[model samples]
Target chain A: MDFLLHIIIMACLTLFPLLGYNIVFGKGKILHFGQEAQSLMAVYTLWVLVVQFQQPFLLALLASLLTTTMLSLLLAQLSFRLEPDGFGVMSIALHLAVLSIILNWQSVTRGALGIPRIPRGILPSSLERYALVVVLGAIAWYFFLRRLERSSFGRNLVALSEHEWHAESLGISRKKVHTIAFLLAGTGSMISAILFPPYIFLLSPLDYNFQHMIFFVMCAVAGGPGSLRGVTLAIFLIIFLREGLRFMGLPADILGPVQIMSFGLILFVAVCVRRDTLFPKQRTV
Target chain B: MPILSLANIGLTIQGHHILNGVSFDVEEGEVVGLIGPNGSGKTTLFNVLSGFLKPTEGSVTFREDDITHLIPSKRAQLGVGRVFQHFGIFREMTLEDNVRVALEAMPKELRNDMGTMEETVRATLEMATLLSHAKQKAGSLSGGQMRLLEIARTLKSGKELFLLDEPTAGVSPKMTHQVADIIGALKKEKKTVLIIEHDLPFIAQICDRVVVLDVGQVVLSGKPDEVKKSKELQEVYFGADPTT
Candidate 1:
């Protein structure tokens, strides 16, 4: 039960961010590489509110989300072109800049030393608490994704994603849709920052690394990137690869190296074998 | 009244002049054919009129409103539907969904809600003789079907001005008739249309008057018969336009 709960928690945590990426990449046709960086920055916002200002949990979460939203707006404003490559580079540049701040802000973020004792849940059993959060988050994310898929906004996004020139001729505002998608990505990262950090009760500058950004990319890639079910399957597949080996009685030392190796190997294989399925369509037929 | 008027539109990109001081106008409910040689800036003029390109000089007035600086999407929302030489339908989506996408591009109040949206989609699909293929992905369509889809989309998109770039390009003679019929239907519905075509017969059949462009300037403006009789038009088509 505990093992299942743990996997589900990870799944739920992954669900929102992946959904967010789907909005930006799947619909908006952006390959945003800075999603995980935004998540780290969101944690820093939470840290400032909860630790330094000693704000209440809900208040701190709101403030953190606000910061993430503003960052998202800045990213969209700076790089929201119809071209995917330029937009992607702008998002990555924003992430790298945030990383610089994280590495240098010793007084606020504790720089290399890291911050500890992040406030934990009120409930005694961490498993039950995590399970509760996961279930609620899953329901919310599911409804949100479904609503997005059917709305007028979704139709406009589909038009732009498939044919920008045609969509523009029809009067679909590319900037408005892309802006909303980037903002949603930011909100997803904010949710991740709020949910995951408290569980570990620690914060470190190392957590804000590019590897984490790559992790999000890997998950998005492994899943169909634009597909909801594919993303869900990918989140589960990743959790299974990491934790399933543990349950199979593998020792930790060898297991860690093996998991890392498989991560790279799987990425390569997925790209080679599932390249068509992994990315958006480039051709007409 | 002229629904669309372009006054001395000039466009230069990277020091190369694509068009220079080209002017034309289409009265309400008129179907105008824009005929020119391969590189005589026909499509570029279409782009400028549809807001894809901002002219360095002159202005575009749609319904007497200057829209020279409006972006492509804004022009679309304001009822300027353009069909490309190549098919512009979202091939990955279902045929009904393709129409739905165009419908969604219009103002919310202008489009039918969920209750009647499907009915509206069916009506547009029927116009293209594609009602039965509503569930089929547009990518699976034949070349003729794709062209028809483009026309259906343009008609339903609530655009007052329609700029069709080589609508019958690469289509068979039968499909060309169907496309011409669709354009005729749009004209009957009183939409102002500016078509760029190389097929002289199709232009004579469908257009009220024909405009000939040579070297990015208007060389002839009259009926297709009168323009076809011009020595200058024959020379322009047979001769190279400009070095640029």
Candidate 2:
């Protein structure tokens, strides 16, 4: 029962970040460089405040949310202002910067040693308690994203993705829309950060890195870029695949390569076979 | 008062002047035809007027407000609509979804209170004579239907000024009259329209006035008959010898 509960919590942790990516970047586009790093920074920020400063979990959560959102906004502004020559290059640069910051910010993050023994006493120290927390977070996120997806703001995002010039002509500010997307993405990441430490009881820079970022993005893209249902399904499939691979006696060192190969295969097939299904085309009449 | 006025607009592409000091004006409810041979800059003028290109030298005024530097979407918000020579519909989207996007882009204050977005889309589609094709993907539409869909989407946007770049380009001859009828209906509704067309007789039939461009310069501006009869226009447009 406890093991089952652990699986559920792990799935939620994996699912939320992908949801963040789908909402912000739209599918098929590569993941931004520093997404996992930014998520890690949020987690570290909350860990420090809660453990070192003896702050309440809710207050730490709020602070972490503000930190990550502001960081994402800054990155987004820089990315937009520079208008980097290529999406892939910009993503790599951003990710590298985040990794370096977490590695170097010894005072805040304690470098590679990691913050440890994070208190999970607030919620009953049981697997069911963790599952309940996961369920609540997932439900809240779904409701919020669904509401946002239907708003005029969401329409603007869809339009921007379809044709930037056309959307601008319609008076939708692309910069503003992008900034909001970054903020929402940060907020989602923050929620994951809060829910995460309690589950693992340890937080580190290595936990949030390019590999995890790619994993989250793969889930989003494999499910469908702009689809809520697709993203949800993708999360479970990825987790199941990972577990299945492990059960089949794959060495830990080969895990990363295996994931990359499978993702590449699936993405190639998706592009060739069901491009419309994976990245459903939107219409602007 | 003129609804839109362009003064001495010039655009140079790769150091070659495409619109050389071209100027024109349209009043409310007027349908103006811009005619020229290929490479004479009719489409270039359209691009400049619609805020898609910046004129090297000249000004564009809409309702007496200078809008030459505004982006296309801002111009669209200020009541400017453009139809491209090629249909720009989101091919994968259904007809109703296309119109819904335009309507949703309207300022919140101008939006309708219809509880359902489909209702608003249906009404606009009906106005564009596209109700029957509302569920069809825009990509699957016949060329004539696509033209109508473009016009309908523009109409749904609540833009008062229309810049149509070869509205009948690639359209079947049988459907050309249908397109002209839609433009006529827009004019009757007090919308300002500027059209670029190769069909002289069609222009004569629908345009209140015709402007002729030659080698990036305006060679004539008058009633269609007068422009057609001008010796310079006849020689330049048809390459006719002066004696002939």
Candidate 3:
């Protein structure tokens, strides 16, 4: 049962943010790499609010989500019409800039030394007590995305993905659909960020880098685009694969490389099975 | 009065003139057919009017509204519907879904009622005789059926003006007749239509006016019989000298 909780907790962590990116990805086929940036940016905001200003927890949480949403919308504005390749490049660049600021801002972020024991938890329990609650939150998020997938808004996203000109000609606004997707994606990242501190006790710049970005993207892609169930399966499978590796007690040096290599291997097999189209192309961003 | 008009429209790309001073007017409820040989700029004009391209030298006005700067979606929302030469049906979706997408953009009063939306979708599909295939994915249809689906989508999009670009490009004679019947139905409701077609008889049966373009110029415009009798149209279409 404890082992089950561990898997449930880790998989649940990735699912909320995955759904956020999946909204745009399912219809647009653009794998946004900046979600990690938004989450880390949220973390920085939460720490400053709770630690620096000594504000109440709820206010800090609200501010953090709002900041991430705005940042996401700003990114969307910059690369609105770019194709998948250009959008990917732009997202990675933006993420790096945010990561750099968080790493170098010693006065505000405490630099690479890390922030310790910032207050976390909404329920009464032990420090690592809310894995089941997190699982519930993930389930709620999954059902929400599933509902969205069948709604008019969801249909428009899919139509936009299939053919932009036709969708627009039928009166679907590309800007409106994309804006909504990005905003939702930002909110998804914030949920994961807010749920993060309770388990991670220590915060470091390393947590806000390209590695997490890849993990976030892979969590969505390996599930298959435009599929809610596919994503659900992918989340647990990836978490299990990585955690199972840790449980085996490999040497620390090879553990990191091996986890990454295993992903590459699965992705390679996926490509061979589905053809070199792991990420399908979108006409425009 | 003219519902949609273009004045002095010119498109120059990389120093080559794609369309040169093309002017025309489509009056309310009038069906106009634009015919041109390859490279004569029919599709370019469609692209320009549909908000896919901005002309270098002129403007587009719809219902007295200057819409030269509106994007494609804005133009669509303002009652301009297009059926592409390559068809615009979302092939992966069911036929019902395709029609539903167009009707999904219908005015709030009609769309808010589930029963009305269903009836609207059903009626639109039945017009093209595609009601039986409503549940199937469009990609599985034959080219002719796909063309019918495209027409059905454009029919229910709630747009007052229809741009039918080659409605019978790659279909059988029977399917072509069905398309003509569909256009006749639209006319009965008093919707304006502009068709880009190659079939002269088809144009005669539907269009009230014919505009023949050649090498980026409107060389002839008249009733179908008058345009067909003109030497200039024959010369442009056949590449033969008018006097000869």
Interface RMSD of each: 2.9, 4.4, 3.6
lDDT of 3 by residue, B1-244 (tens): 7999999899999999998999999998999999989889998899899998889998999999999999988888788999988878787688888888788766565466546778888988888788998899887998889898888778777788999999999989999998998899899999999999999999988999999988788888999989888888888888886668
**Tens digit per residue, CA lDDT, model 2, B81-177:** 8887777666656787677777777666556543467776887678667798888987798888888778877876778898888889888987787
Which structure is stronger by DockQ: 1 or 2? 1
Candidate numbers sorted by TM-score from highest down: 3, 1, 2
Give the top-scoring candidate (lDDT): 3
Output the lDDT of residue A118, model 1.
77
The candidate scoring highest on DockQ is 1
Error of 3 at A280 (Å): 6.1
Model 3 ranges off by over 4 Å: A127-129, A275-285, B109-115, B241-243
Tens digit of per-residue lDDT, candidate 3, span A1-285: 777777888788778877788777655665577877877778788777887678888898888977887898876775577766788888889899888888788888888877877655564355246786787898899888889877878878777777888788888888888888888888887887777665666667786678877776666667776678987898899889988999788999999999999887776665466443454333321
Give each model's whole-structure lDDT. 0.81, 0.76, 0.82
Give stretches of model 1 more than 4 Å off: A81-83, A121-124, A245-257, A277-285, B112-115, B240-244
- lDDT per residue for candidate 2 within A1-285, as digits (tens), equals 665566677778866766777777563132355567568768878988988778887898788877888788876786566643464467667777877877888887777877788888666687787798887888778778878887767767776666555566555666777888877777778878877877888887777877777676667667767788887877777776765676667788997689678877766765566565543344432
Candidate 2 chain B lowest-lDDT run of ten: B107-116
Provide the lowest-lDDT 10-residue window in model 1 chain B. B235-244
- Fnat, model by model in order, equals 0.79, 0.42, 0.62
